[model samples]
Target: MAILITGGAGYLGSHTAVRLLEKENDVIVMDNFTRSSAEQINRITAAAGRAPEVEDGDVKTKEDLERVFQKYNVEAVIHFAGLKAAGESVEKPLLYYRENLQMTLCLLEIMEDYQVKKLIFSSSAAVYGNCESMPVSESTPKNPINPYGHSKAMIEQMLEDIAQADPAWQITALRYFNPVGAHPSIAVGENPAGTPANLMPILLEAAAGERDAVDVYGTDYDTKDGTGIRDYIHVMDLADGHIAAAASQKHGFHVYNLGTGRGTTVLELINMVERVSGKHIAWEAKARRPGDPAENWADASRAERELGWKASCTLEEMCLHAWKWKEEMHKNTQKGE
Candidate 1:
């Protein structure tokens, strides 16, 4: 039986598909290229030295999903289809609700029909919106502030209920922190469409001279350098966490925080990128974005203890990997390849 990855051409999904393919798993990728493209599949093929069966389909469409389920001997699914921008979700709450929620609902119904009971959901730390504590854990109260986070929390609850109702269903929701960096091979990385809302991508853009200056939001926070601190995990480490989740024998619904369990300030990140990329990052101070947290890390001990997974990449390594991808992409664009 093969593993079916929804939105497999995306940043995280592409990396996970590469890792699964490298592990010799029969993998199939289903994507419509809404936020990604076919080039990601090419890169995945190049990196894994093998290609996954590609289905040009959207997760929200039943016909698109049914065709793949009819063709492949699917054993498990890693759902990564959804709109991710928090600000955009806030601006278009209905779109977020309709797209993100409907995609999962449709996928779950089809999976039930096919008797594919194993699943690994791509969730986010935004579900724990503005926590009062330092490091967030799996048990953190889910108080999502925006539609994007609300959609994720609602899907997680739906998965929990379904798992409780059915003994055969095995589900894992991996709540991810800020996933930065790229694959060491420079085969895949976080290259979002349009202006990126995340800090890592923005910093990379500034380093690549695409943007004029990086905005240092809220420099008066109580962090060591008076900047927001976030737990930035390498994308490959996150991909490995999914592999561990897929290989687990544990039953029922499980949730794990995928992060480095450490925080890096904004200035600290800028310094690291400059040090690694040899490019100076110019920045300007801006007021705190409304809903932005002062500090947010992760207590990923449960993932280590349960799934035998821990993020081992250093901050410098993350910066270096991301900068390397940016540089490579620049060269590729110049060559018009």
Candidate 2:
């Protein structure tokens, strides 16, 4: 039975695919290349010394998923396929609900039919919307403020309910904080299409002159630098966490928060990126984005205790590697143009 990674060419999925390949695990990648790119798959091939068997498919289609399962003896699934733009989800709530929720439901149904029970659910910390408390644990009350986050919450709830109904299913939900940085080799990273809403990518764009300036979401926030604070974990660490969760042979739906247990304000992150890229980041203070929290970090102790996984990369490392990818992608875009 091989491991199947949905959205395998995406930012986080691409990194995870390379790691799983490096570990000599059989991996099958299913991606539609909607939110991801073909270049990332090429980088994964370069990193792994071979390409994972690709299924040009989407999880929203059950037959597309079934075809992959039939082609490969899929025993476990790492689900990462979904629309993830929080702000956009707010604008188009129906699209978010239909795409995110339907995809998970369809995937779960097919997985059940195929008896492929093990699953590593891709979740987000956004589910803990506007967290008034610092350092949230897995047990934190979920109050997602955006449609995108609500979709993830719905999937988590679905996973819980499914696990409860069946003792045979082994599932673990990994709630991620802000995942930044590229792989150590800088081969594959967050190379999102168009302007990225995520913090690091926007900062990289401004520093690389892809954008005129980075917009600081809010300056009146109750943070050390008057900007929103977030726990940024390296993408490599997040990929490793997925591996640990997949390997844990535990039953029932267990959830873990993956983070470094530290927070870096938006301004501080910009400064670090500037330090790494040696490019001054121009900025404009903007109004607070609705549904954004002032601060959010993770108590990753549960992940450490259960999956024996903890993030080890520093903020400096995140900035350095992110800069590396940004520089490389910028050059590639120029070459293509």
Give the winner by lDDT: 1
Off by more than 4 A, model 1: none
Clashes of 2: 0
Q: How do the predictions measure up, each by TM-score? A: 0.98, 0.97
lDDT of 1 by residue, 251-313 (tens): 799999999999999999999999999999999999999999999999999999999999999
| Least well predicted 10-residue stretch by lDDT in candidate 1 | 187-196
Residue-level lDDT of model 2, residues 92-135, one tens digit each, is: 99999999899999999999999989999999998888776888
> How accurate locally, in lDDT, is each candidate?
0.94, 0.91
CA deviation > 4 Å runs, candidate 2: none
